[model samples]
Target: MGIIWSVIFSGMSFYWAMGGRLGVRSLGGALYEMSLNPSPSFLAIVWLTGFIKLLGAALLIMLLVHRHNSKLDRKLFYTVKIAGAFLFLYGALNFITISLHAFNIVNYNLDHYATFWRLAFWEPYWMAGGIIYFLSAKRT
Candidate 1:
């Protein structure tokens, strides 16, 4: 389940990073539009971070698979825990930031459907997945 969630998260990040167009009216497209006004450095950093996150999630999944096949060692355990911690923090920070931004928009009477859905669902799903990873990492 963790692997599945990670794969989805990784794929979405990679898609956005690669400038793949979902549709002109899609949330991803909106993000791409938003990115256009930002400096190139900012866009580069965003892509870089997306790639880094994808790599991290992939590596974490591989590590877990390796541990499952072999005897779990202390080093592996700690590494997995660290990966889980990173996942949790990344998801949490994103969730909190988006949620806060959505609320701010609401205060100004700006109702963005995309932002609302993200606040209500997308971000929380990732954060919850991160929490699951953390809890699942504890014993294995």
Candidate 2:
């Protein structure tokens, strides 16, 4: 289940990394209609982050599979735990910020919400891997 969810998230991250339009709208109330014509630097950062996230998700799946096959591989288990924790943190931070921006919980510029929809959509799965990893830790 974790691997499946991670793979799905990796696909979404890949799409975002390729400058796809999944994150081009707001997910909160009041249809936000702002120009997405951001500076090149901003776009570059977004793409870079997306790519890194995609890679991380892929690595997560690989690590989990390895751990599954080698129950005695303590090192791989730790790696999975750490990686999952970090992924959880990353997604949690993004989720909080996006939710705040969209729901007007914080006074952030609405334009920033363009990427909110994409991240918000993957929030559940983003943390699912982490939770799975943590739970697996107790088993072996």
Cα-based lDDT for every prediction: 0.60, 0.57
> Using Cα atoms with residue i matched to residue i, what is each candidate's TM-score against the true structure?
0.59, 0.54
Largest TM-score belongs to which candidate?
A: 1
Candidate 1 structure quality by residue, lDDT tens digits, 18-62: 666553123433454665465666567657767765665665566
Please give the lDDT score for candidate 2: 0.57
True-structure Cα RMSD, model 1:
4.8
| lDDT tens digits by residue: candidate 2, 14-118 | 564455655446433332232145456655665665666566555555554544556456665676678779767877886787677667777654464445553
Worst 10 residues of 1 by lDDT: 21-30
Superposition-based RMSD of candidate 2 using all C-alpha atoms, in angstroms:
5.5
